[model samples]
Target: MEERTRAYLRGRFGDYYRRTELTPPPGANEREWGFIPWTSGPGTTMVRHRSLLDLGSIEDFLARKRPRHVYFSAGRYDEPSASSMSEKGWRSSDLVFDLDADHLPSVTLGEDSYAEMLAKCKDALLRLLDFLEDDFGFEDLTIVFSGGRGYHVHVRDAGIQGLEREARREVVDYVRGIGLDIDEIQTKEMRGNTPARVIEKDGGWGSRIHQRLTALSDDLKRMDNEEALGRLSEIEGVGDKTAKTILGAVSADQDVEGYTENEEVEINYEAISAGNIELGGVGMRKLIDAIAEETVSAENAPIDEPVTTDTNRLIRLPGSLHGGSGLAVRRIDRSDLADFDPLVDAVPETFVGHEISVEVTDGGTVELRGDSFTVEEGVHSVPEYLGVFLMARGRAEKGQE
Candidate 1:
């Protein structure tokens, strides 16, 4: 790390340690805390079997050592220690969901920049939160900004604590919409001489399909025939023939006539006939299923699967500083998350208004307090928040402008 970066970390570690919550994992007398005292250190120094009775000791230790990184295990233990899990007899751990922009391929951070990447991850995090709370009916959950490029949702529901690794993997899969079968989700209805159509059902993936299809229908209406066909074909299972059929059906100037007793609907096939190409019940069903699958795939949260699956994972302590970004790992209220800007909200009070000079080592753009600026290769005077941020990222070094 740069000298100034190290100095900033050293100065702020005490306040961070004091403010950060040091809650041990459930049912544990001691929690294992790990620290990286220096950036060039061989590896993390494990400080285990620490009694949680005194927060003062941990604070004092942090003030003296001034670690570049701080972390604590999710797993609770009878006797928490790094040397042996057998000795500890692992009791239980909170189910952790790590939503990271680094894992998401949708956004290229090099071009989109960190702010955009963070926004993408935050949106995914909110969706995951909805899935956990409204879908899975989980209530005791904690949300934390990971201090770097993402967020962490910690499920503290007592029922979920003892879930095995495979069980946890299932939860991760559900959130990611992995291996969801569209065939099983869509409701098939036989309507007169026309082909069977798949209608969206009430819950689970069905509701998602319905929502996406509704939006897609509106969007398709605005596009020309070629554009509409191209858009439909972009869906995973939608082929050229299926896309053309969907485009024809959507473009046809005919309202869904009426529903039968079974809610099987009828469409005017005459209106949909663009040349000799006609859509049958089976073909229409296939197109709808394909669109549903595409919707589900797009809606899947870009979370790090391994983090959620690992029962014994160690996560960054909340209110601690992230070594890579010099931002505080902040505990966020679910209500305030919509307006929370991590760059502005997670900055430490110590560096809030202070000014510092730094030399840009890496060329890129950075956003601070809603202002965007290009990072040129040279020294420049910046606020303490941005200065420490760039230095921590190794993008800038301490120097006179």
Candidate 2:
């Protein structure tokens, strides 16, 4: 890491025990791990500024750092799947503030492009404002720069009260819309667990909308309740900013847990060409123009297990314990740091979705799904940082054991 980058991190984290890399835990050989978190693309999203910085205090940063975390990841860059966060299996309940697509950058070929990136970022802000109004039943939303690569849009009106991470994912997906893969992201930004904040910010409409939704409840007579429940669609105007509240007031209700399960998928290939690609019922995990990045061809990817290979694989994810921030590692161990690599790369033939389905029998059609891969590795070292979301909820309910 450059001095300036170190300084910037210091400015934000203020003297975190520094290590050059995250090595694997000693008892195990490193290659057995897979996934990396925190850095962005091996070549994309580099730390552009070089000024040394300081973060006075972590508590202050968390309360006022203004950057809301939405995802957690860790792993190596050298061997893409050799290690990752999910494999470590942890999670967190970050103050997830996702933005609309317009909020992202449209990096044109070579020129001083910060202006362009920020412009698109702002344009996405406007669209987000409208998005909260239409999909979320709110007329306002707040925007903040992530200090790093993206933007953080906060909707902290009382209406939401506060959402657990999994629920937040559903909200962001709803607000981001469908036709596009709204529920999944190829990289961490889509998950929003990275440390992010506004370069410049001021609170306004989003806050106002949030407050209204929070207080706007009614004591309806049974008949009135019946009537209101019948017109669930219009109650949104009564200032309900979230579907949770609106639906709670509605007649038909579904188990929030079952309805919002993470759609599971498995990606064995990575770095396929972009454009005109679709994954039937799922989204392409990370659709980069692989040819632009390297000479790795479709046939060059590793297939240790055939796409059609079959096995009674049983992955019993913590299903009963779901939807909570699992852990905030006090310090990333150094040996684990060696497992951390900044240059690992891989082509994901399939990136798994949230829903984990068991292949009932062998010899049935097992296909590779979703073309996803980190353009650069070592960005997110703890691959399963987001996997144990239940841990977060478990902590909160069980009182932080």
Candidate 3:
């Protein structure tokens, strides 16, 4: 970045801090603070290992430094300003999950637009929330848009605050569905002295698979006889005879486990509820295994595992500007996350309602604030917000006044 551009961004950042009163993270004094100042270089330098006291008040420090980016340590410490990790008496750290769009498998880079990438990231966020909220039963959660390419979820539940790295890794594995074995989800029921293994129905992966199987049953029930038969035969191991047997099992004479006479019940609910899906049939077992894989893929949240395990990681501060994108690292309320648009909602009000001239160094289609337009390689006057975004992204330079 040019010196002129750096100076302009720095000055505007200072203005933003002067008017914006940022709420410090809990235990602010016990957490280390870091910031990246606008420097005349291609790479950034992180000024870290400073406590809240070293920076004075968050507001005053921001106004004075006008940093390019700001962050707070997820780990709280006794000697927060200590120069080394061993000296910083560690207490506890929030369980942090980072979902980056660039890392998402669904996203096809160079094809997906910024808006599309962000939308996919939001989908991933919802899946992550499902694991944290429904599976883990965590209540104290803070969600933030990273302002550059992803989202961050901070789990501040007191119960998990002091979890060591290995324990945190276990949490990560659960959410990511790593090393998940269907056999592990089974429970043994003692029938006399002999034990019988059954798939669980109450919670966790077993419950998820059961729900999927039930949904499949409902879908088959809705289909015509020929359609359902064709669908059943399409399963990898289900032959014509096997499919008919499965149909007969569904349309059994008895109503035990909700399978009434002449009713087409694809799954053996009696066996499933008893945690013995294998009793459903060989074809049914194959179908259940396929559904289990699908359930894991569909439900598991692909979060950055290292972030959750790292005790002393520096995370971008909420409500602070991301220097790379010139957008706010916004704290999004859970209720409003469904409609949050990072391109539009994360644009800083400090850069809105104004026009600025900039030299288009490496221009292309730019999308921001609910509009999309193409910019060629030349000097042009545009909205301050767009200009700042382009400048921060290194696609444009500040034009002469």
lDDT of 3 by residue, 1-401 (tens): 88989888889888888989888888999999999988776688989999988999998899899999999999999999999999999999999999999998889999998889989989999989988998899999999999899999999999999999999999999988888887888777774576766666777878887787777666776676567767767765566665665555445352234432245444443443343544446645666666777777888888888899998989999999999899999999999988898999999898999899999998789889999979989999999999999988988999986
Which candidate leads in lDDT? 3
TM-score of model 3 vs. true structure: 0.87
Weakest ten-residue segment in model 2 by summed lDDT = 313-322
Give candidate 3 regions above 4 Å deviation: 186-199, 224-276, 280-282
Deviation in Å, model 1, residue 159 alpha carbon: 1.8
Provide TM-scores for the models.
0.80, 0.25, 0.87
For candidate 2, the TM-score is: 0.25
Error of 2 at 285 (Å): 31
RMSD of each candidate relative to the true structure:
6.2, 27.0, 4.4
Query: Candidate 1 — what's its lDDT?
Result: 0.70
For residues 80-188, write the lDDT of model 2, one tens digit per residue: 2323334432222112243322323343434523334444554554555544655466533433343222344434345553344455545544444322231222211
Give the per-residue lDDT of model 1 (tens digit) for 265-328: 3323322221111244444556566665676667777689888888777788776788778888
Task: Tell me the RMSD of model 2 versus the true structure.
Answer: 27.0
Query: Candidate order by lDDT, highest to lowest?
Result: 3, 1, 2
Candidate 1, clashing residue pairs? 195-281, 196-281
